[model samples]
Target: MTSNDTPEPTRPVTLWAGFIIMCVGMFMAILDIQVVATSLPTIQAAIGVAPDQMSWVQTAYLIAEVIAIPLTGFLTRAMTMRWLFVVAISVFSLASLGCALSNDFTSLIFWRVIQGFSGGTLIPGVFSAVFLLFPQNRQGIATTIAGVLAVLAPTVGPIVGGWITQTYSWHWLFLINLAPGIVCAVLAVWLLPRDRADPGAVRRLDFVSLILMALALATLEIALKEAPQRGWASPLVIGLAALSLVSGLAFVRRSLTAVHPVVELKTLMNRSFAIGCVLSFVLGIGLFGSVYLMPVFLAFVRGHGPLAIGTIMLVTGLAQLATAPVAVVMERRMDARLMTAMGFGLFALGLGLSAFQTSATDFEEMLWPQILRGVAIMLCLLPPTRLALGNLPPSQVPDASGLFNLMRNLGGAIGLALIDTVIYGRAPVLGREIVARLQAGDVETAQALGIPASVFASRIGQPADAGTAALLTPLVEKLALVQAINEAWAMIALLTLVALCSVPFARAQSIASPQLQAKAGH
Candidate 1:
């Protein structure tokens, strides 16, 4: 475990096999988020939950997942990677079955919570393997595979979920996890390298720290979820926010002073790692914001079906896959800081271009923006990962990886809240202005809206023409929503550009490559 000692090498066959299993598990975990998202309407109908309460289907999973993310470090130390993956995948598969069979909202949320906790560890576990299991020479390729799954799952989730829901029952959405989860569990048990659990690590779990950590994250998640709907000033939202702040401070103090904290708060002291965490947060904002915004635009504004929306979104994932090999090659030879800068620059460009879109924009118009975002995302992920974990000693890799991934989810939670605030707050004002202009008989506005001159004349003295008003109301609402979405896109572009400032702060060390070492020795 000492820094000076060389860790034992993993067999290539075992290493690659274990990595593939990890990828499948990680993909399922991330995929479930968006997959269930697209199917929530159907699920709500089936379970008979009120519309307002249906949001909990997604919220419960996210809150549980966020709480479980930082616990990976402690769990890995206690259970070891091999047994942990087996147990986690098993629990996830069984929970998936439970979710599929649940008849009511309460049971579904209970199973979803279990599913989230089990799947949460799989994400950080895969990243930890990048530094823990692979030799320096193969780390780039290993990371490429893991990165693709991490980003790709969320990209294609709607497509897969939509197809499943349209073709089969909503039950199949959860049922889909069964076979893959089982396969991943078996492969992990058979191929992963065995290590003994550290009994000392198990005994050191700070129960108070665990309680505070859970309270802090859960309260924060609830506060954000309710803020957009309940008003940020509502007593419930304010109370939760205050509770989260208090619990968060308590958790930080306890973790820093505890003999063996559940999460190692000290990882933030590494300058490069800290910068990497910030970049990951900004990336999450753009990533989740775009994903959430697009579907809303298509479904509400364009009246597109789930299948059609999924089809359009697939363009982003295709572009990412096409760029993966090129990103891998760049990781081998390029300065990571420079690559990261270029990545965020392109991402910002993409978001900025989308900000100019009109209500008439379609898949054809979105092609280039999606392409730019797809290529930029891989660049965003790979370099920051190396910068954060590349030089850490083996003992710190797991703890650092957990914290790194947590920042991204935390960013997604906060980003989604902000995006909702913008949309809900701005749309009504825009709608009122449009209605007022039309009511005042602004000729330019009438012409722009394509209302016939005859119809405009006919309604001159009438009480706003009930039928015409009914037709125009929906159109005005759609136009207002489109503008609101454009504003959200602009905000994301600004965030992505802001991420560029942190690139230079990353450590300049190249990832270790055996060939480079050999050449230097010669």
Candidate 2:
């Protein structure tokens, strides 16, 4: 039976119970990555991995997750959403336990792959339920819950990770997932209604397409991750990039023609859905980029610890929570396109404001921009999600949800790569220029850098003593790095503003299915 025709629980409690469970699963999954990121140094030391090899802990999970995301449509069809959630959460829980118990890097990486694959499905699964289970009127609130979890998990991950690692140990990061994973799994089985699995769908698994998709995404993620350190032109990076491109093209061609495609790329033909996907991609860039930029800045520029960084970042989350109700109200009453435009505009303003920051900038200086971003991220997410999947038929929802979510992740990957390029590429050049100006007797620059006139004169056209050069070197590097970071923030803002042009392409009205509207009316 189609999703609309499937029987839903008559009681509201049961429906929402199942949904909350799903959200719990999704929240845990997304939160896992960030929490691990915050505690990686400890993890690396404990696991005895080289500094260079340490990134694989996260990279392995990311590559696996990216590959699994697109396969959700097929998996949901084969196993049914209920069983899928049950199995995914069970595996995720088991994987978490395995990770916590791991004594070696190899075992940790293995468990992380399993954890990532299982966790990946939870993301699209939660989104698919908006149309599959909820009525049109309630979808705004439903979307709000999902969007909040989506935005909130990353926002608070560092805080939670910091507390766990600092107060207890790094193992708690994985051990913590055990309770929620089990609880979510049990709740799914008890609360979610069962649907018959499609045997035909299971039989039609496109192995070739799956392999190509996996290779494409895996290589792409690795390439992006390594490009910054290895140099984009390095043979390893170039080979991976070429492999990703070829595999990606093959996956696209195969999915288009295959009778039982893994992903539903054709959904992009719908103007609204297509625009929503674009918006999702751009939002990913801003959301993930900003999240990345903040912690690094606080850690390196300001020398804040993880707990402090996470605590300060809470401003954005608090702002998001405050604005969520407003987003819910607007989703019901306002033009999604207009709401989206407003969101991107405010988010850009926040990002642009952050671009002007100095090395000394702190909580007070960042408060307003954090509030703007906190409020704006929800606006950016809620409407675009509704616009993308609200109108798609049940059969299409899974595919569309997977692809839509995939865009956000892809945006994060691509955005970070570009941001890194800007930072690393520009910092040295700017550093040299600033040093040149200092040598050229720019009085204001000298005064601002706290360099004595005699010292400046001594350094002119000659290498100064180690003490003077040491002081000046660090100052120059800090200034140059901050400038580069500002450029990155500005670039993100411009990209966000550019996303505004696509808002007009989204349907102005809610496109929720008639059945959903009818159910809401009842």
What TM-score would every model get versus the actual structure?
0.95, 0.95
Model 2, global lDDT: 0.88
Per-residue lDDT tens digits of candidate 1, residues 1-522? 222222245588877998889889999999998999999999999989999999998999999899888998788887887788889999999999999999999999999999999989999989987887776667778888999889888889898999999999999999999999999998898888777677577676799999999999999999999998888999999999999999999999999988888899998999999999999899989889989989998898778988899999999899999999999899888899998998999999999999977778899999999999999999999989988888788778888999999999999999999999989999999889888887887766565466787777667656765787898887788778888899999998998898898788788975547777334322
CA lDDT, every prediction?
0.88, 0.88
| Model 2 ranges off by over 4 Å | 1-7, 447-463, 510-516, 519-522
For every candidate, C-alpha RMSD to the true structure in Å: 2.5, 2.2
Looking at candidate 1, the ten consecutive residues that score lowest on lDDT are: 1-10
